[model samples]
Target: MSNYIVRKLKLEKTPQLDHLARAAGELYSRTVVSFWRTVRKKNIWLSGYTMERWHTSSSLHAHSSDAIVQCFYNSLKSWRIRRKTDPHSKPPRRRRWYFKVIWKSAAIKLKGGKLRLSNGQSNSPLIVDWYWEKPSIIELGWNKASQCYELRACYKEEIAQPINDGNVAAVDLGEIHPMVIADGVNTDIFNGRYLRSVRRYQNKLKVRLSKLIDRKKFRSKRRKRSIKSKQKQLAKLNNQIKDIEHKLTSRAVSMLKLRGIQTLVIGDVRDIRNGLDYGKKNNQKLHQWSFGSIRIHLEYKCKKAGIKTVLITEEYTSQECLNCRKRNKPKNRNYRCSCSFEFHRDGVGSNNIRAKYLGIVPVVGLMARPSGLRFHSHIQCNLTDNILLGNPRDSIAGE
Candidate 1:
């Protein structure tokens, strides 16, 4: 199968480049808004004719007009789709600064360490740093914080499909453990205690900052500065969280790849927090947990690695007993059944998730018991050291 991937590289910052980017973005946005107004007035959907009408009168640079039109069409398509589900969807609004410029093949020229970009007015190229080979589609965008432009190149390549080794790994995602993996033979647990602690600290810091900002008078310079500082801190914390998620997901995927596992069954909990009444603290934790983000990361990585990913409803995976096929309510992290079978709650969930695909009840007897269990922690915490249970086995017996 073939897939397209986008790579972003930081571009050198210059006042001239920044001004041009903003000017182009503003022009494109204005054109889009104008077309949207016309469509709304006529009660007609956006089409190439509507875009062509606006494009003819647009004062945007010739070099960027094609790209602007493409952007407008894409946005209008999205808005139309959204409006189908939501009649109240509004048209695109005006933006303060336009930040991106799309360049056609002829508009960009790359030679050695320098890039020549068309400024729309003349043949003279705007010089920028370039190291990688030129791509078919090039997009330049401005970064407000860094006061620089960014380069994004898009390309496609073929990827080999992963071979099916008949081994399957089921993942159970939770707030406490984060991720629990069972390949029908061995179990691996990824602890989330450190992540929770970091989140709590960040929340406390945000509250302290908010109080300090509120103590200042409204519209005061000191208050504005405090607000800016708080925003910066929040952005920094968000970046940190994203970095951690990327690393954890990568490690999990690497582990699966190493074991020659072909099928990955992930328990889907997308709407787990839809209308739960878990009180103040618990609700806050649930809202902050980035389950969706983790799933996305896992999916893309799996796709690129040629691994088949399946999502199954996780309704009773955690509550159902594996031994007697009876429903048992778990207390804390341990699940106990009336038949005298007991095991880690999340581990059982993982096993049952796999069973859903295999169409068989997982056996918990000594012969089919997991040979060993591995514990991994995302963060370096003394309390969550890796522990191995029983003797390690060559492969998980998924009978």
Candidate 2:
């Protein structure tokens, strides 16, 4: 299997590059608006072949134009699926003034230290200084946060053969702990307090900025500047959250690999927000939870390591006691059963998930206490180890 990673390169603003990108964006906007109109008037979704006919009219490389249409088609497809559950779900409607430009492998050329991106036969190609190896795909777009045009280079890498050990682990995801993995013999908890602190700060900052902006007169220069500043601040916080998540997942995968784990079973929480309607604060936290992103990162990272990931329905996995097979609602961070069974809440959930996946009744008595890991920063974590279960053997850095 192959996995792809993206690197962002901020472009040096030039009149020529700006003109080319704006032209491409205009083309994309026109294509989407036109496609939406056709769908509305004829009440029929245009096929890919039909969309390709308009490529000849575009000034961009044929593949680049096709990429824009393909993106619109993909959005429409997602809307179609979402509408099944939410009939009120809106389809692509608002017209974008500017959209990102994409260049497929066929239209990208790297020679010397410069990368060339074709723009069809009539126009000159766009070239940028590139110091790294060539990428499979190149994308150019304006970043509102940084107030600059950025380039994204996508590189595909082959997966390495993973350990063939018969050991398996199950992950229980949560808003508090983020990740808790339990193999038959060991459990590990990755604390998420750092993530929650930044998220809370971001929310407060957003509210404060929004109030400040609201007090200003509409269309005033001060208001516009405040809005721009808010976007930049929030974007930086978002990047920090993303960095933490990536590091947490990477560390989790590393620990699993070190333990010779071959299969990872993850609790599926896909529909957790389907009908959620808690109070304002509670609902906002749930909505902002990045469970889906976590799962995607874990899946792809595990695939790159030749470790298989299995998603199983996690219904009652956290509430049901693995020892007595009885349902007991957990309180706080602990799960206590009347039959004298007690353990960490997240660890219990992971153990139950593991049992569900392996089709075996767990002897919770033999399970080791979960090791705790909390991130001090994206690069380092503080670890509390259980000597009986054995440490991750420094696979993940710990103090």
Candidate 3:
């Protein structure tokens, strides 16, 4: 749960560090793309992409005199090489000789073994510092331009406080009420502004993109502009959603800490996208749910905040009633349980979700609260393993 970030600044009177960072990032991406294309067609192999290919027995680039070769051998034996993959693909990053020699050389040349940045000039040993109680290690990362530089000190904090006795927070992640939180009494709803805004932009983009075809611009120009604009629009929407979710989750988890909520009961929806038949309709709703994205963000954020998250089986959370044990058979957004359990369908589900955390369903392999709460009876739902809905264990259908 502990990771650090390395930040750098550009020398005064020079272009911003952001420019260099962006360039480095782009180069890195280009290199990976080239490597993938080469590897895919079997035009090159592993040696060409890593330190191995940099110094052959006779290759002078490595300065492989007996001493340098021996040094490399010993270094290889002693150093632990960790791997990183391409951000956008299944391909493993090919570590080249330039990275090995250049980084090592830079580190060696740096003052106190830490890299530095100067006026339009690269300095050895990029600088860094440590915060909290995490260990201090010199880690290297690839910048946008594919340059390998040491990322200096990382600031990471461990905020792990033990949960209070028998207290828990039930989190209902959704589209409308971006976050419907039940703290056993008052329900706080974080409005779905992000969702609404994103949907709006998405709709606008579709209309705009369609209209682009009618523009008087040349065919290639129009196509290129259209594609670029579409990508920009999508990225903007995604960032907006992510920012809202990040802020909302962090705020919510922090609230839990204040409330003495020991454990966070998170409802893990397998996939809001899969159950539906794929097409325009499914896509329209899927965009709004962002089920997978939000869940993933929350998982890591909660962990970092030291809040233990318990992912519950979302069986009939959407339909099961809290009062009167009634099954409302939801006709719309509101849940009118058959047994007349009056409340927001989401509220009833949230209650059941929380109950499960309190030991409501144990036999179903649901890792619930260690306390004495138990699962409720008379409900139905599933999507086992997310997609694979197992047989109904409770009286509910598709349990």
Candidate 4:
């Protein structure tokens, strides 16, 4: 399988490059707005004919114009698809700046320790310091937050498929556990309580900052600085969370590969929070959950390893008992059924998810007498030996 990775190159800031970037951004924004208006008025899709008609008199360089048109077309296509799925979807909005570089030899050139960028109407290229190997595609853009020009180089790489061992694993995602996996032989529960704790702490910090800002004078320089500092802290926290998630998902994928799992079944809960009223506190917690991000990590890692991934609707996965097949409403972290089956709530959900694909009701005692059970948490612990039935307190102990 072929996949691409992007490497960012920070360009040296200069007056000339800044002007060029600003001009490109303005031109891109105008082109997008005009193209969108034409599509709406003519009730037609974006195409080369429409692009040629719209930009015939434009002053933008040929390559730059082509790149902007392509980007707009792709965005429009995606918006149209989303609009069909969601009737309330709105059309794309115009931006103050929308800089982008279309991949072309004329638009961008690389040399020893420096790169050349096309300034739309100039014969001479804007030269900047950079050092990188040639890439399949190069894109340039300006980051408003950082106030700097950035280059993104895309390089394609081959992915190796894992050797198949006829094993399948079912994954259940939840707010508390994050991921619960069942691979026939064992059940593993990954604790997400630490993540929840971190989120709660961050939320409290934000609330304190908000209250302080509200009490301060309007448009005060002190208030603005405070807000900026809070924003920086929040951004740093978010980056840390992302790093932790990457490590957790990497470990999960490695475990699956080691077990020779060929197929991965993941429960899909994307629409679980749609149009549901679960009270204020519960809703806030649900919103804070990173279910989508976790799924994305699992999917790409599995793809890179050539392991098949299937997303099955998770309706009633948690409510249905894996032991007796009776419907049970789980309370908190425990699941109890009328047939005397009791287990970790998330584990039951994951086992049932695997059973769904097997087209059979799960055996009553499978979860109770699993071949093995493993507990993992984000915090450091001495349970690194991978021992079967290790102390749960050591694994899930508070950080």
Candidate 5:
């Protein structure tokens, strides 16, 4: 529950350090590539991501004479880099070479509390790692050259049962409002106005930058500083948006806990990978509408409170009018159809969201069930390594 980072200074200003780093990067590539190639062949039926089903890789080594050596991490790497070894034979890779590990075994030894320090510095260059006991996974933070720092360590504590008088609130993610929230008992909770403003600023900046480029004035220091300023604004906007979500979501969660709402119900609004783009007019909006990132934040916060999030199928939760039982959701932002049924579009979609605190959805590739509905199609997938949802209070016990 406690979080702090361990930063160890490891700059050689020496060519030996550079050489060790290069060697390690090459070795890391060699090992990861061979593993992934075999993995790809083994899981031919799965998507590249789903290949984690067949084989999930762990770190490998590049041995060195020195017990302490450099380390590396490539966030999104090419498959070719993993296998290619003849440095002179292949074409240049867009992915740049960075830090990598050379003495992993020794590194592990240091991690286990062995004392090998000299000159009051860590004998081995540090590798940033994260361990969360609740969800139970160890993550390695890749070194970020931009800040000259790895995302080393972050302290995010899970609050167990933070409240007991609140009620279950279902927040629907949307295009305009960004977040449309409603308690299980029916109350409005929304946050998205600033998000819209941020979007506009981003668009304006993009247009301005584009104009400068067209005029061939892109090299001006003024333009560069302006762009940087815009980036800072974008970041500030992101923090504002997330802060709103956290406040609302956490309040809802706390309220639910207070009301004896043992389980918190939420929609699994994830990227279905069906070509969803927020229409990138420029660099800003493209980065702002980080769908994947939003979901991740929600999941992590929910996990801290031992809450359950139901990932209802994404096919038609919005359009299928929760009231009339009619599938009339529009692709655009409009909520009303030819029929006179007018409501806050997202609110209506959310009304149908059933508090599914049971097992998995039995039906695959079909419309997701709403909250408080009996679902025989419910089978449970483990959201976290420690928690499981097997029982149901609604009509379907098999759910």
Candidate 6:
């Protein structure tokens, strides 16, 4: 199996490059909109090749135009799938003036210490400084905050051999604790407090910036400067959030591999925000939750590490007491049952999820004291000193 990741590089701003990228965005919008109009009006589906032919006069490379068509078709295909379950699901109809420009393998070249991106036959090629091997595809994307264009290179990497030891683990995903895993014998909790704090700071900064910008005249020099500064800060915070996500997922996968775990089950909370109305503050926090991003990172990293990931509905995984088979929503981090059996709430959820997936009854005697880990920016992961539930205090150190 093969796995791929994207590396983003900042591109120096130039008038020619800016014009080219904006033109590519226009071409993308025109291609999608034109094809969609044909589909709606003529009730016909235009093939990618046919759409590519329609863009013969485009300044973008032939392969770049093909990428646009491919993107449009993918959106249409996704909409088709969603419409089966969601009757009100709409097709891709929005049009944008500036879209990210993608160049396929055929339009990319690397020579010596330079990378060349083909625009078209008559236009000058975009040659940039390069030191790494050529990537499979390249994308020129606009950064509105910095008012610049950047490049993203996608490269394929070989995947590790599949782990077939048959050991399985279940994960409970939440906003406070991003991931909590249990494998009947071992339990691990990954802390997400830092991620939440960073997001909170971002929201506060955004509000302050918005207020300051609103106080100034619209489109004035001060307002524009404030807006740009705000965007730059938000972008920096966004990057920090992404850094945490990558490290968290990577560390989790690495630990799981070390545990000789093969299959990973993740609790699905996809619709947690559909009609959520838990007051202003709570609503904001939930809306900002990035479970989808965490899941995506986990999925790809697991694939690369030859670990299977599965999602199962977790309707009562969190509240149901494993000991008494009764529902009791924990008020805090610890869950206590009427039968006197207690454990970390997230651990209990993970255990129940595992039980549901494996079609086995949840047993307290089979579970171990859950170990806790807190993620830090300076370190990969740090073991937290937490009191073990129903086990010796040295249980974490033994692991």
Score each candidate by Cα lDDT: 0.71, 0.82, 0.50, 0.71, 0.42, 0.81
On residues 14-39, what C-alpha lDDT tens digit does candidate 3 reach at each position? 23333433433443334445555666
Q: Give per-residue lDDT, candidate 6, residue 98.
A: 70
Q: Which stretches of candidate 3 lie over 4 Å from their true place?
A: 1-44, 47-166, 213-219, 337-340, 360-399
Model 6's TM-score against the true structure: 0.76
Q: What TM-score does structure 2 among the candidates reach?
A: 0.80
Candidate 6 lDDT by residue in tens digits, 1-399: 787777677777888777776786787788778887898899998887888878643578877877876777788899999999999999887776777788889989899878999898998898988766789999888876566788888888876655563888898888899999898888899899999899999999999999999999987999999988998999989989988987788778777777768899989999889886899889888888888999998888777667888899999999988887899979898999888988998999999999889988877787789999898876543232331111122343464
> In candidate 4, what are the lDDT values of residues 1-399, reduced to their tens digit?
787666666666776556555656676676667766766899755675567556621334567667666666677778889998899887556665646655565666688867766545544666666545556667777754455677777767677765552678899988887888987657888767667777888899899888888887899998998888788777767766775666667667767877778889999999988999899999998988898999998897777656778899888888997766778888877888888877878888888888897677776554443332223435332222442112223334432
Ranking by TM-score: 2, 1, 6, 4, 3, 5
Predicted structure 5, TM vs. truth: 0.48
- What are the per-residue Cα lDDT tens digits for candidate 1 across 1-399? 876556666778776666767766776766766666777798766676556556631333464666766676777679889998999987566554665777776777788767777766543457776555566667888654444677777656566776663688899887887778888777777767666776788899899999999999999999999998888787777767765666666667767777777889999999889989899999998998878888887787766666788898988989888888899889887888989988888899999998887888786663143322223334321121231111012012211
lDDT per residue, candidate 5, 9-111, as tens digits? 2232344344444544544454345445655788532233333233321223212312111111232233347447645553222332544333322333233
Write the candidate numbers in order of decreasing lDDT: 2, 6, 1, 4, 3, 5
TM-score of 3: 0.59
In candidate 5, residue 238 scores what lDDT? 58
Top model number, lDDT: 2
Clashes of each: 2, 0, 29, 0, 32, 0
Q: Once superposed on the true structure, which residue ranges of model 5 sit more than 4 Å away at CA?
A: 1-151, 154-169, 213-249, 268-290, 320-324, 327-342, 355-399
214, model 1: CA deviation in Å?
3.5
